[model samples]
Target: MSHVRVAIPKKGFERFEKYNPENLKSFEQLIEEQNGDTYCLKLNMHLLRMYNAYPQLVNLKITRLILLKALSKLPYQHFNFARKYLIWSQLIDDGIRVIIDMADLLENEDYEEFWMHYKQKATILPILDGFDEAIRKYICFKVGSTRTTVPCMEFKMKLAVDKEVLMKYITQLGWMINGNEVKVFPLMLNDSNDRDVIRGIICSDIR
Candidate 1:
């Protein structure tokens, strides 16, 4: 009599055990060395596959690291790299897709919409340490470099922060809060070309 071989799928917890400390250490090393490298793109995809299959098995620390790296490249990469990686991995759902959507809004300078979306995804905040701060810094830099002064109300809306919280960032930036306006920089009553030059100078200071 011929017998047919049957395969049994491993239990979820059993699969989870396979991602031991040793494996995690090795994975972290690879991520550290290949950050921003093209080869790392494939490595990220592999991670996404595991996350999609058994999110409970994959560590949130690892997920946060990869997602933050992707976010850091925004506006510059325009999230094309992130989109491609997610598409190839077929894991563009849930928090992952939400982050990419946020990146899109930031790239387009749609601050109000981005904040609204961010609030809706507050549940994902635990895995996104420093995300709001990073975005706020980016927006502050953009606004500071481009404009000498911005209305406090408008600035607060752009940052999605209350007046008190906005004051903290303004103080840290060495900007003055005058009446209803935040002075981002000294008034440069110059032509557009001169303003562009001043903007370049201000941007260089951050770099």
Candidate 2:
């Protein structure tokens, strides 16, 4: 096999040999073979995760530079996922930042937009899901209310549906309709409140 250049772009790749000890050519072995290159080592997303930089990979014929190129043109870093390994945050760069920017759609509560844009990146959907769930569930956000000065369009939308009766069912109302995800603004739900978020919690307890 030929020597692979190890360049550390903004992509999430670290040379952790244990991740893929299965590979015959270890990082040490590769380093011994290479003559000289400023780029120490490089791996694509899957290769990185397989080597334990993160937790997983996508089964596609993708390349490190290609992923980095795509990520380089992106605008942000860090994304939400359902089952992610946050321990490997050190593998950050413009490329990974771009990949994380994809999570901005979920954070901004633009499901339609999110799906529309990154649905194709679904090859890495599992990884994306990990980050998405991690981000949305942990980040604190409050439901919108007329009494509060902060803008909460999700809450306001509930108010618009039926100002008087909406509050009556605010906690249980189905104000959002993006695909099959009926719950609206679930990330901001606080179980104590009598609004959209709390209703689901109370209903589950009753059942």
Candidate 3:
């Protein structure tokens, strides 16, 4: 598989080395600006090094920051981002391994296994706000885009949420619930001409 190589900024690391309680807020802002880039991965590694140097600096906030940065890479790097951090296991904990496994499951669309791991190990670090909601959005997008209709029970299982919550999500997407199934509309097309042509082809194929 091909991968994009992102150049890490040396100046960023130089500035990161000066991070302390006094400047942590600013440091966080700098890193957040670099989110979704490979530079964030390097920053996370630097954070692990700092934690190793001063174990007292390790806290829920720090761990959550690292985990969030790792998660931000999921769309581009998938589990590879998690795996890159495994070399520091002696300094950290098994949380990296758990994240790697969970990421792999999610990438493979194995929502059941992902939830099992999430529920089992979520307490290892700080609670990731909106984690479930983000995963649910991905599930809805993936299943809804492909399937015109899905069994309500199956959709609930895929989202790993209760019926009430599922209803809210589907309703927000403008889907209709009929007995045991939920209807999913195709994605909207912005261009009316293209939309008409696509609809005609679909109708002809169905007929």
lDDT winner: 1
Q: Give the TM-score (vs. native) of candidate 3.
A: 0.58
- For TM-score, candidate 2 versus 3, the one ahead is 3
Clashes of 2: 17
lDDT of 1 at 44: 49
lDDT of 1 by residue, 14-51 (tens): 34433343344455555545433332433444454445
lDDT scores in order: 0.61, 0.35, 0.60
Please provide the root mean square deviation of candidate 2 (C-alpha atoms, Å): 16.8
Worst 10 residues of 3 by lDDT: 78-87
Give residue 79's error in model 1 in angstroms: 4.9
TM-score of each: 0.56, 0.25, 0.58
Estimate, for each residue in 87-135, the C-alpha lDDT of model 3 and write its tens digit.
3433345665566567778778898888888898877644555557767
**What is the Cα-based lDDT of residue 97 in candidate 1?**
64
TM-score of 2: 0.25
How high is the lDDT of residue 157 in model 3? 90
Ranking by lDDT: 1, 3, 2
Candidate 3 accuracy as lDDT: 0.60
